[model samples]
Target: MRILLAEDDVSQAESIKAWLEMDGYSVDWVERGDHAILAIEQHQYDCLLLDRGLPKATGDDILTHLRKHQHNTPVIFITAQDSIQDRVGGLDLGANDYLVKPFSLDELSARVRAQLRTQHKGTSQILMFGSVSLDPQAKVVKLNSEIVNLTAKEYQILYKLMQHPERVVTREQLEESLYAWGDEIESNAVEVYIYQIRKKIGSTMIKTIRGLGYRMNLDQT
Candidate 1:
């Protein structure tokens, strides 16, 4: 999954980014709320971890703007604002969850999971297509009951494909999911990952569209 963190505190942002990355999420961070807005416009994120006291644009402003434009991406406010009214105000502003600072990393992780679960409500977290199966929580993919070893990026690509079986997933979308700000992307990076995935899971499983992108081959038996 991909996440955008809008936090100005350098040390705290680094720690949060590292922790989320370790949990199998690709995270992009911005120190200013305007930069966060630009990132939001540029990429699709699974969630947003926002600090209320952001520079340039406040978290409340961003949240209000997103809701005004009907952007339903899940957002969690991670701020030092700890008053009851503050929590109530944040929730009223459309934040799905709120975390006061000095919170445990474990709890933060759990809250993120909870919001994701709510976002994907009624959809099984374990994705299945044909003979392949993926467990997002476990970060494991299996083919015909056998484990398939995959790098983090490889798993992310496959996960994207599996999420939309038999539907075209654009190359740009896949690239966005795999890379964060300032991460170097080779021209053929998506193709390389696709090549590696096919080698491990079987080539016929993913199909390339001549003028578009790629899709999971649901007819692959």
Candidate 2:
């Protein structure tokens, strides 16, 4: 998953970023609220880790602006304030979860998982399309009960396709999901990944549209 962390505390940000990255999340961080907003506007994110107090703009202000613009992305306020009123205020401002500073990394990870689970409308932990199953959090993919070997990028493509079974997720959208800020992307990277996925999974599992993009063929599933 992709996440945006809006925090000014250098040590704290680095710690959280490193931890989340280790947990298989693509994380981009900005130290200022305006930069956070700009990042939000530029790319898609699975979640937002926002600090209540920020430079130039407050986290509440950022959340308010996002809501005003109809961005329903899940937000977790990572702040030092842990009072009753403070918690209520953050929730009222549309935060899906809240984590106070001096918090355990495991707790933060748990809350993030919870938010993602709630965001997912699926009824299963393993996303399935026919005999193929994917444990996203575990970064594992199985073809009919047999574990399929996949590189990180290959897993990313398959997971993206599985998430939107039969739906056409454009090349640009897939590229964004596969890459983080400042990461170099090859022109044929998407095609290469698709080829790798097809070789690992069944060829019929994915279909390429001439003008559009790739779509998972779940009808046979």
Candidate 3:
């Protein structure tokens, strides 16, 4: 999953970004609230980790603005404030979860998982699409009980497709999900990766929608 982290502290942001990437999440870091807002406007992120204090705007202001505009992306407030009033205010302002400073990376990861599970309405860690099963937490894929080894990009593409089975995903959408900002993408990169995935798995699993884009067949098993 892709996440946006808005933290002004350079060292803390780098540490958190590294930890989340190690846990198999593609993350984008922003040092200011305006940049965070711009990132949200440009990209579709699974979640947001907003520090309460920001350079351009406070985290509460960002959350309030997002809600006013009907952007319901889940947010977890990460700040030094650990008081009851602060926590209650955050929740009241539509934050999903709140984590104080000096928090464990493992705890942050667990909270992220909990929020994603709630957002997706999934009770299990395994995501099953036909004969293919993906363990998002573990970053593992299995096909018909046999483990299917996949490169990071291949797994990313497949994960994006499986996340929205039966819906045609445009090449631009796939590319955005697979790449971070300023990353160079070759022409026909999506097609190349798609071909490689089909060769590794099965061609019938992912269907090309002629001129539209690509979609996974819901009946594949």
Root-mean-square deviation of each candidate, in angstroms? 2.2, 2.8, 3.0
Give one digit per residue, the lDDT tens place, for model 3 in 1-221. Answer: 78999999999999999898887678899999999888988898889999999989889888988899899889999999999999999999999999999899999999998888777664336778888898876678998888999888889899888877878999998888877665588989999989998887787888988888898876684
What TM-score does structure 2 among the candidates reach? 0.83
lDDT of each residue in 75-121, candidate 1, tens digit only: 99999999999999999999999999988989999999988878877
Better of 2 and 3 by TM-score: 2
RMSD (CA, angstroms), candidate 1? 2.2
| Count of backbone collisions in candidate 3 | 0
- CA deviation > 4 Å runs, candidate 3: 122-130, 133-141, 163-166, 209-212, 217-221
The lowest-lDDT stretch of 10 consecutive residues in candidate 2 is 116-125
**Preferred candidate (TM-score higher): 1 or 2:** 1
Model 3, TM vs. native: 0.82
TM-score for each predicted model, relative to the true structure: 0.88, 0.83, 0.82
Report every candidate's CA lDDT. 0.91, 0.88, 0.87
Instruction: Flag regions of model 2 displaced more than 4 Å.
Output: 121-130, 134-140, 147-152, 210-212, 217-221
